[model samples]
Target: MDSNWGSSSNLDSEWEEHRRQMMEEDEEDDARMRTNTQLTATAATLWTQEQIQQEGPWGGSVVGRSNKRRGRALGHQKLMMDYFVPNPIYTLENFRRRYRMRRHVFLHLVNDIPNVNPYFRQTTDATGNLGFSPHQKLTSALRMLAYASLADQINESMRMSESTSIENLGEFVVQLFTRTRMSTFDNQHMRT
Candidate 1:
């Protein structure tokens, strides 16, 4: 009976010591977590302050665009056809025969069309290469109208993407309609 009591007393002392150590470890873990949380909060606050200082009061620049060419620049290369004759596709004789117009008339159209539709203007890209020039756009439209060619077929020789060729074709039609309407019709309508 005395031996059993001694063993129980020993176990009780060891258990109490272990419990105390576990509690200390738990407290240390809690302190470490609080420190980490505070560090994270401080970092986030600093980041926010830096962002505010960088952007000034509100987002976007107070002044206008940084330069004249600010945000305006072509993003793709589609104007290579500006002076490309396409060997046999767009030769002088072929153009005249296919479009049913003289070379001079075609040239005149090319010059005048871009005056009305700014979409056909030659654009300089930021990296390199100028996007579709007026002549290329006009040629694309003319070929589409004359040959009833698909955008894919036109893109093959023009070096333009299919979507761009289609978009240019649509713009070309609108400009042509405006020109034809102004030229063919009287400025003042006749009163009934």
Candidate 2:
């Protein structure tokens, strides 16, 4: 009877360890699901797959036709000149003429697609009008958000350490834009 009691107690201990491991795995899965759900909800709010693909360098895992040349670094003087030029209308018009695309299309791409300025939300009031400068602000915000998202996904899927995953994520973001022939032009920073 004493031996039987000891064997039963050992079995109980083994079952407890198994139960604990299963619980831990289940908790981790739930946490991951919650994170994924939050990201999905955020993505649904702002961008569609088509917009993400066409708007910037990260083109939703597909390649598009674009020139494959390294861009020249713009000097501070050049950036200042471009910003302080005081001819938003003229500059936009000149750009449209050069591209031979409709001005409205350019406006849409800049304002809606990139929507770089963190302050500016989608405005229903402005119809066919461009209203922002220093386009880099908006593009930077978009890029950072994308990089973070991709990094998180990599960490989760690959089971990499956090720091390593983040470093890899940065490289991945750079490559995402660079792999495309149009990467130089699509990335606002790369545009000379």
* The candidate that achieves the highest TM-score relative to the unseen native structure: 1
TM-scores for every candidate against the unseen true structure: 0.49, 0.26
Worst 10 residues of 2 by lDDT: 68-77
- Global lDDT for candidate 1? 0.61
> What do the candidate models score in CA lDDT, each in turn?
0.61, 0.42
Q: Could you tally the backbone clashes for each prediction?
A: 0, 2
lDDT of 2 by residue, 1-192 (tens): 999999999999999999999999998997797567456434533443333444454322355655322111232224335432555424665544543455466445456533433333423223443322323222233333544444234333333223333333233233333343244246546654
Candidate 2 yields a Cα-based lDDT of: 0.42
lDDT of 1 by residue, 97-139 (tens): 8667876787787777667777877876565746666766777
